[model samples]
Target: MMAFYFSRLVEIFPFFLRGLWMTTKVAFCSLIICTLIGFILGMLRSSNIVFLKRLIGTYVAFARGTPFVVQIFIVFFIFPEWGLQLEAFPAALLAMAIMGSAFICEIVAGGINAVHNGQWEAASSSGLTKLQQLRLVIIPQAMKVIVPPLVGQYVLLIKDTSVVSVIGVMELTRVGWVTVVRIPEGLMVFALVGILYFSISYPLILLSNYLERRMAI
Candidate 1:
């Protein structure tokens, strides 16, 4: 029976590939959105503007404070009652965007803050506007502080894609769940799932390590 199930898994390998594809799509899209929003929010949070800082701080607190799966459920289940109906895929992306951006926001804000105030003062003395200062001076200096942890956060976000399986997003974990029912071999099915996840995450892990080493230098 083990051999039979193993063979069955082999035959349905393509299905897993499809799930992998979906997982990739979700992870990629969410990462892009998260990075962009996180940077903007991070920059604003790091700014001297008190109101923007407070507003973003509240948002960050909510997103970081709550469990991700609970956030996913709120987006998928609760929003419909408020007349916002989203399909599973979009809902997954929304939840990811919310959670990922909050974490990245903190990372970026911390990075920006790590840059000495003298850098900002020097940039200002050079007649650079706030935006110009960030673009030409602050952000570049902060990149060393930011890139490693940002990449590490990306790996976490990618793994978090599996949580969207709870919403029927048909990602790798979902594929494993469905397969296990038919194959009746939980370990084998999920080992395959884990391997697929590792394949995607391992490269990012390597990149994160590389960035950390480079940053430390």
Candidate 2:
């Protein structure tokens, strides 16, 4: 039975590949959008401006406090009542961006805050504007603290793509679930799903570890 199921899976491999491609596209696009928004919000959160800090803090808090599945439901189901319509893919990406940016925002904020006050003073003493100080001196230093965890966060985000399958995005997890119904081999179907996810995430795991070691030294 296992051999038969395996053969069945192999025959349908291209379908799985299509699902994997969809997952990759969503993850990659979300990562880019999250990184940009997170960095900007992080910088603002780390700044002396009280209002901006509080505003972004509220957003991060709300995002972190909620369950991702709930967030996805809200985006997909609730938004249309508010006259904002979105297809499955865009809704999934929006959910990913919102959730990912909040976490990444915290990471970036923590990294910036980790840099010493002395570094800031030194840059200011050199007559560099605040923007120049962050650009030339601070962010460069913060990246060392940021990169390792950022990579790890990326792995989490990739795995989180599975949750987006709940919205009918036809991603890898959804594909596996659909296949299991047809193949009647839950273990085999999902095991292939696990392998595919690992194939995508394991390299990032290694890179995260490498960055940790490199940054520590």
**Mind giving the per-residue lDDT tens digits that candidate 1 earns over 36-83?**
999999999999999999999999999999999999999999999999
RMSD of 1: 0.7
Model 2 alpha-carbon drift over 4 Å, by segment: none
Candidate 1, which segments miss by more than 4 Å at Cα?
Answer: none
lDDT of 1 at 44: 97
Itemize residue pairs with steric clashes in candidate 1: none
Full-model lDDT, candidate 2: 0.96
Worst 10 residues of 1 by lDDT: 175-184
lDDT for residue 118 in candidate 2, whole number 0-100: 98
> For model 1, what is the C-alpha lDDT against the true structure?
0.96
**Backbone steric clashes in candidate 2, count:** 0
**Per-residue lDDT of model 2, residues 169-212, tens digit only:** 99999999899889999988888999999999999999999999
lDDT of 1 at 73: 97
